[model samples]
Target: MPEQVRISLDAMGGDHAPDMVVAGAEIALKRLPHLKFLMYGDQARIKPLLDNCPELAAVTEIRHATQEVTMDDKPSVALRQRRDSSMRLAINAVKEGDAQGVVSAGNTGALMAMAKFVLKTLPGIDRPAIATYMPTQRGETIMLDLGANIECNEDNLVQFALLGEVFARVLYGIEKPSVGLLNVGIEELKGNESVKKAASILREIDLPIQFAGFVEGDDLAKGTVDVIVTDGFTGNVALKTAEGTARLLVHFLRETFRSSFWAKIGYLLARRSLQRFRERMDPRRYNGAMLLGLNGIAVKSHGGTDALGFSNAIGVCHDLIANRLNETIKAEIASFEAEMSKAEAKNPDNVPEDTAQ
Candidate 1:
């Protein structure tokens, strides 16, 4: 680990203000004593909360900001009008080298707009993708485009594949990770033009990626592929459907357990197993959604998540900084662009005749 990894927090962005933010910082510090937080928000609101956790207060330095971006605020409005807001300041810390990353349970659009404007995307990247982890049968898998870009082209999908590949390799240390396109079927003719073209290009690329063809909705939870690439629309729909299904299953399970006297007895005996299942399904463990492809790390926590969930978001930022994820992504992108450029130079008019149109 580096000497230190400091994180900037938008204390007033979430449903719970300074209290949950400060408490979450305390919880994160317990696990990462070396972690430092630049708390940006109303100092009067946060100082009292810090008083309750004296140790956390020692490592945290508060920066007073009277303004805050509310949930209803438009991304454009927040970016243009709220320069002194807590969210903007936290992101500015990253650009200014005061922190490696920023975590916020703030307005998603505002946060994204401000972050993009401030940190900017890395070279060779058109738009940043939102990535998050999901528990799978084998272990855990990372998925991208969780509602960042609504529409994408062949190049966009291919770039998302690259994004996910670097994330898995750096975060999980997977030597060679398999990538798949989310589609209706596994056939070559499946999906729209963008996905088909993306798949075709991935097959012929000289990259060190294991392209696993196309995967349907069923393959997501089966751990069918290490990374599933798709446009933001499909990815967001898939995410919401999965979440709704999980909630329905939980409700049915709870009712089933309450159905009979014998069921309660069975539940008592299997309590530990059920508890483990609950822990695996806990949304708090997967609280942070990363705005991948930025020059600096920016993680967005769920707006309504509690203190425990916010702490997990901070941990995600910590992991990214400690692993130098942006640097790794930059290196891969440079290699990818260089190889493609060499291929173009081989053509007479620098036009890829065999390339997909």
Candidate 2:
């Protein structure tokens, strides 16, 4: 028997609604047998699908939700109106201690807003950050502030570093992960004021974090460091650009293969190798974007993703809760804060007071 990890699902949220949610749960059950799903949605739609998958049905308990957050609903509107919605109800389950984490494929902004409002940020954390793992040459690199905060100050970047560092350990099982600040260039005077100032502060800080200086655009795929920290604006743009580039490369490869008979013959000869490469680059393998620094875990699945992608998202939520990631991050932040307090007391300029937004 494996350890049980309880997760709440927004069954009626997503482009495909209850069908994809149920199907994803079925797929996740095969991989994580110890998962207990607290399915939140209209029982009428979800139960019918659960009946067909007895393996998942045995471990799931459906909770009725009359409403659901729509894809187009703004975060503010969703929070103001959709109280009994499936997404909100699922998050509430985590808040009420009924589930360890919540997984949703609904509106991204709405989910983040609700999770932040409901779960709140962990101790010593001013704001929560969004983080996710992307495959790199070394293995996988953890990147943070991926569409959570549009514009962040130096202090916020430092906070993202802390969250990303903790998540990298959970992701790669490394004790002390090398953290880097994303920048235009690696030179000391090349980047903007924020990156330069952040690097300066991180170098001065006396914490457990392994500050790995700055990483440029080309360093993303090189796996320059285990953890990449940036503002949500930059991180989000980088993530989208990477995804687009991957698709572009795959398209070019396919076009080249079909351009000539000899090319097609060559493709056939390398089909097995190409397939391995394809599987390695698949985005579904890295589907979950965790909203970090929240008191409880919340994983956002791509709304357009299928059963396989959604299952991967659920796995992220499970691993996060089982590893007690939030507790570890809270502890790390507390430890750093204590150290900073002592330094600040000794020298007023040790840790600059964060007054800027």
Candidate 3:
């Protein structure tokens, strides 16, 4: 870890407001003692909460933000109008080098817009992709473009693949993580023109990536690859579907155990195993969604999450900052660009036939 990891928190952004935000910071502080927070929110509401936690207050600096961005606020409006809102100010902390990263349980679109406008994309990166890890049968897998860009071209998909690869390497500690493009089928002839073209580029690109030709939706949970890349529309739908399925499974198990006396006895006999399963499936364990490819680290927490979930989001920011994720991604992208230039020089005729069109 660095000497200190200063994180900016949008204290009034989430549904629970300054209360949950302060509680989460206190919890995160216990775990990561090196953390210092630049809390941005209405001081009138936040200061009293912080006053209750003397230890957290000792390490935090509150920056009063008069404006507040609601969940329903449009990204364009938040970016243009709410410059001093808690969300924007927190992000600005990172951009201004006052903080290493920013965390917000606020408007997703607004956060993404402000982060892009403020921090901007890294070198050689066109668009930033929202990435997060999910528990899989094998372990955990990283996936990207989870509702960031609704519509994507082949170039965008390709960029997401590279970004996801870097994420797996940095966050998951997988040196040669396999990358796959989400498709309807694994066949070469499957998927839309964008994915097909992206697959084609990934297949022939001179990068040191393990390109798993194609993977279907089922492969996501099957742990078929370490990284799954797709457009935001499909990715967001898949994410919500998986979340609903996890909750449904938990509900079914609870109802089954409580349905009959014998079932309760059975649950008692298997309670330990069930508890492990529940912990593994808990959404709070995976609450942070990383807004990748930005010049600085920015993590978006679930707007409706509790203190524990928000603390996990803070932990995500800690891990990303400690691992120097952005610097590694920048170097890797530069190397990839260099390799592409070499390929172009060698095949001036037609090696890279613009398939992204």
Candidate 4:
């Protein structure tokens, strides 16, 4: 049998804490026999949930954490002030090698702050970006820096593209994934100064992946490119907008179908296709955001996630751990660094700061 992958979960991190979190843990344990979970939170609250699942109780362990970090709290302050908060404890578990990965539905800002502080960045990476996959007509596209760092420079955008490319290649099994810079227009001269500068740099570099030029917001759901790169602020806005629009469209469709007997007949005729479409677009299927370029494995879920969402997040963590994503990313980054070093040595003065070792 394969060795078990242990995960540290923040049982009190989300809006539906202790219930959804505990329920997700139970589902994960049931689905993955070789998976062990360490739940961190108040024992009193967690114990009652665990009582219903004796099998999970046998394999899972609970670690006591007294403090809780709220979404409104400043990330830096929470990280510094709350020594025993569930988020901190869960991250510490990964840092200390007690768990192979950490899963949380906690305050994203605080989680990112604490993760950067604890896990640190890989050698060539200046900053860690949160990457998430979304289902699209073509398949799925990897979008990065989703609300992790709002303000980014041209160099930051380039790094996010490279990181996102490697992530798509590894996680989605795409060979030489095509990377696209999120822009307002597809023309080379379009977008702001930062986008223009990044595009110029991207054109100059000869990366292992394919650079597909610029992609607009509408191109995201169409999967016009394999990887989409942008600053956290833009990426976050685009993601939330897509999610909200999908929800709204689904609601409108359901209301239209239920309005009349004729509409009900039409709905029944298209129900199978609609069901498949809904399944493909369901946010629960893609619930976790990966903190790429970090040394350790850290997966973040939506703060308002329910049990199904949390369970899917655990499954994502399991897949990442099983696939040895950290090792693969490290190797890819090392290769990129070596290539950059060689290029710099040959042309020292002209080497771009973004690609320079």
lDDT of each: 0.90, 0.90, 0.92, 0.87
lDDT of 3 by residue, 1-357 (tens): 547899999998888978889999999999999999999999999999999999999999999999999999999999999998999999999999999999999999999999999999998989999999899999888888999999998878888988999889988799899999999999888889899888887876789888998998888899999999999999999999999998888889889999999999999999999899888888899999999999999999999998999999999999999999999888888887887788778876545545433
Where's the lowest-lDDT run of ten residues in candidate 1?
Answer: 348-357
Per-residue lDDT of candidate 2, residues 12-33 (tens digit):
8788878998999899989888
lDDT of 2: 0.90
What TM-score would every model get versus the actual structure? 0.96, 0.96, 0.97, 0.94
**Stretch of 10 with least lDDT, candidate 2:** 348-357
Q: Name the regions of candidate 1 deviating beyond 4 angstroms.
A: 347-357
Off by over 4 Å in 3: 353-357
Clashes of each: 0, 0, 0, 0
Across 191-286, the per-residue lDDT of candidate 1 in tens digits comes to 888988888778766788889999988787888889999899999999878888989999999999999999999999999999999999998998
A best-first ranking of the candidates according to their TM-score comes to 3, 2, 1, 4
Q: Please give the lDDT score at residue 303 for candidate 3.
A: 95
lDDT of 4 by residue, 1-357 (tens): 878999999888989998999899888877888889899999999998898889888878999999988888799898799779988999999999999999999999999999899989877788999999998888898899898888888878877887888778767788889999999999987887777777766776666868888999999999999999999999999999999998999999899999999999999999999899888877888899999888788999888888988988898888888888777777767776676677788888767554322
